[model samples]
Target chain A: MNHNLPVLVLAFPLLAAFAVNLLGKISKKHVAPWTLASLILSAGTSLWVLKDVLQNGKFSYTVGGWMAPYGIELVLDPLSALMLVMVSWVALIATFSALPSIKKEMPGREHLFFSLYLILICGMMGLVITGDAFNLYVLLEITSITTYGLIAMGKGRAPLSSFNYIIMGTIGACFYLLGVGYLYLLTGTLNMADIASRLPALYESPTVATAFCFLIVGVWIKMAFFPLHGWLPNAYTYAPKGASVLVAPLMTKVSVFLMIRIMFSIYSPEYDFLMHLGIKNLVVWAATIAIVGASLIALTQKDFLKMLSYIVVAEVGYMVGGVWLANQEGLTGAIFHILNDSLMTLCFFLVASAIAYRTGSSRIADFRGLFQKMPLTMLALSVGALSVVGVPPTCGFFSKWYLLLGGVEAGQWEFVAALIFSSIVNAVLFYRVFEVAFSHSEEEPSLKFENSRILETSPMMIPPLVVIPVVLLVIGLSAGPLVREVIRLAVPAL
Target chain B: MDAWLFEIIGKFNYWIYVVLMMTGFYAMIRKNNLIKKLLGMNIFQTAIILLYISMGSKVGGKIPILDKEQALAGAVQVADVVNPLPHVLMLTAIVVSVSVTGVALAVALRIYKEYGSIDEDQILERIGKS
Candidate 1:
């Protein structure tokens, strides 16, 4: 209940990561349990923090008791508390699944892998919890740096992937820093709340306008928003499955959260002159092009991971477009879709991991007769695919429903069309994989590649199947309550 | 003499910072060699350090000293004080930036070990062959 819970959520993983690094040097056996325990504890802390935030009002805890605008501060309101719970909880599931996969994919780097993994989790938690602007840039670096470490642990083309990631990520952070410099020059403040308070008086300045553009562009690069997403497909494709599943599911979504905070809270909707700077127009068009362009590109990829990478490009569009609509339904949809997209991508990547584990390949062609060998895995993939396609009763459908409604309310039928178009493209792309998995390959002549690997299942599939369906259900069943709260907070601004 | 040197040093530091930052960015983008790219990253991060230290300067300013005499005298005026806040913040930022560069270099070393070449085009060719 104390505001210290927010700090604890970050501190536990960070300390555990350091301990795990030490323990790992002595004996690798301790790495798995230590990592799991640390992550699960973080998840528990987030849940408790969420409960406290809902029961109480917004609470702030200054790091080192230095007070706001001077000392660093962490705040737990509904938005951040919910994000912490989702991220840490999902991180636990991902870590649970990471164990066997990491052992197989990267046998030598268990200690470094888990330590970097926890560091990344700490960074994301810091990004969500901290109320300081410049501090957010520091936290963003923490996550980005750890992500490079994780990706570098992969086997094939990993270094190059990490290199590309480093280049893009450094540019993103630089853009953010430059923007922070502009804000400081104008307001001479570094705190988000302080900046918000001061920005209104300087709303008409070209510097403020420039600052907002840099900040948005920086966040967009971090999120891998389209046209700036050149680094993503290769990075995700080459990274170890353990790291890919963790990052591909959550990192961009967290960056998107920062973008939303910058847009709504720091910019403060009441500033009429700044609000007229045409950010909404820029976001809407960027999202529109991303949705159409990414879907088209995804349709052409033959590699499994590469296809999923392109799909991520499309998914970013869905979230960004929802935010730019600037209406209740749109914002609610954007918020709720963050959950849906995370779970859906988790399901997708987990299935990709399973397929790679069995066949030692990630090519779409490798999926022929997959259903015969791995029935349960295929079924999980089907659910993930259905969700991606926005099929009814799944979480993805509800997300798209809200997004579409938002678009219509904003009189942007073109965006609604783009959403539907992407969904249809998803159906086509995933169904092709499905059809291949269902049928026997015609290439084999005399002897069939024996289905000797009975079921071809792993210990990793359990958490994903168990949790992903429930997530889908929760999105549908709890949409009313989630939307209500989002409306409550956002209505005043609108 | 101290004031004159401080003015010259403060302005000179900024030019080096901007040039180094640009150099690092150029090498990172222009070169195909992974190790050189990491060297560039180190330079880029060094530029941020210079920026922070520049922000910390105040002409004829003393280091932050807390004593009963100074506090009672109220001698810590804005004009006579260096802003140590940016320096402290920069200290944290420097540690993080170095750690990042360390990891990036580590990854580059691993890449060299695996592919037998740190050149991007050569590595891509090897992967394509595989």
Candidate 2:
């Protein structure tokens, strides 16, 4: 049963995506419901797998019943288990919410949308599950290619944005392959555990150093560190609402996880030379720039989703900086922030999608009197916005708190400043939208605004309002316990 | 520095790998055409493939075709063979690289049809106006 589970998890989605693509010809009506149903079941199975992991400590399944170090292996420990559940849960919610939005937005591309969506989920899951380094790259490419396709489905300028994303993403994946090549050249192995055991002896060689550099740069691209993040804003802004909601939450976070695995697991912290290479300080500085720069840029955007796009860039910095701090608290904050930021970003983008659905625009100016126009959605948006601004009682605040504390504990005051600057900039950005949403439009309709419906948009408003707040509350309330657990799992990596 | 160069070049395979990587990177950065850029990406990917294959090499080793009779003879009595693992891995990586390139080319063709240009600057100009 254990031997079969990993293949089963991946096969279900792989088959479903292919089926959806084929079935779209039979009847377009069968596409959306079938896609959603498969995702719901996928999410349930992922949760069950997570439960099994938490209870059993760890489980290893050798693909094709072959032994490890030779055959493909799928290992599920707490970290990956947590990630699987997070990816699937967010994906399920995002997929369901996407239905009506895509229905209206793309009009003719819903079947393709659902198919690419399923493929993206499968790719992310494959990245999380596969214990082979080379296989992870294969899955990463799958995710990137499918994502570019999905992002291009947006109306205008989307294909251009998707084109830029393809260039950057291709470079990123190539860099990762190069890095893996370096490691394989040194050790002649692709399995993570095998490479881990073999790597320390070769650390003195300059080839190892080169490999380290290659790996870090590669993952940094995917993680979208400051200088390399040129492709992100447009990609997020111009993609369809469904694509943005789906990709924004998991894509960068998964890359960061791979980075953590490489930095700590593949090359353990006990490597004396790696510590002396000033890699930590380099990461700290890059992350600081990313945090402050992205936040400030986010403040300058007029479009609501574009502004949120820059915030996502800033959020990546927070996680990268947190992890690079290389201490228990720092690592814990980084890991916890993954969950926090994923949910928070999901909420933000979902609300944006809902607003876009209602107003047919995501321009800040168009949101004037949105509070009256779409009360439930705007309320949810406000909560999500406040969360992004890192206020208490929202998930965003707790993660930022730990991140700030981690900086101080590591005596990295500049990073603390970055976090504070990020907070202020986020506040400004969120408030700009909030003001428009709250203010009354000068030319009010003759009809009473109170006559406006309770829920603004169907299939869109409901998911964000329900899923976003509940996630926010859960993170805020259970932060202490969650932080403790993240710390435990992060120990091996840090 | 001379000693370093000699040592690096003496391993001709590593030198070839480095040259291939540099060529690919240069083309990717310098090329104006999308197809040229993708060709560069292919070259860049192939360099890694060479690197992996080179890694699996052993001094005076034969191809790793497992002989059931020889293996059963004894654990100590064995053919000194090159590692086949990296080669196998590279085959998978090559397939993935090609698939990504194929998909990317398809997207690029679609992009060209949509915007009526294949050059980055012109494409950007058209997209910007949109």
Q: Which tens-of-lDDT digit does each residue in A345-378 have in candidate 1?
A: 8888888887777676788877887887777778
Give the Å error, residue A332, model 1. 1.3
> Any residue pairs clashing in model 1, and if so which?
none
Name model 1 segments beyond 4 Å from true: A272-274, A441-454, A485-492, B1-23, B66-68
Of the true interface contacts, the fraction found in model 1 is: 0.47
Give a tens-digit lDDT track for model 2, residues A400-448.
8888888999888999999988888888887888887788876853223
Return the DockQ of model 1: 0.49
lDDT of 2 at B121: 83
Interface RMS deviation of candidate 2: 1.5
* DockQ of each candidate relative to the true complex: 0.49, 0.58
What are the clashing pairs of model 2? none
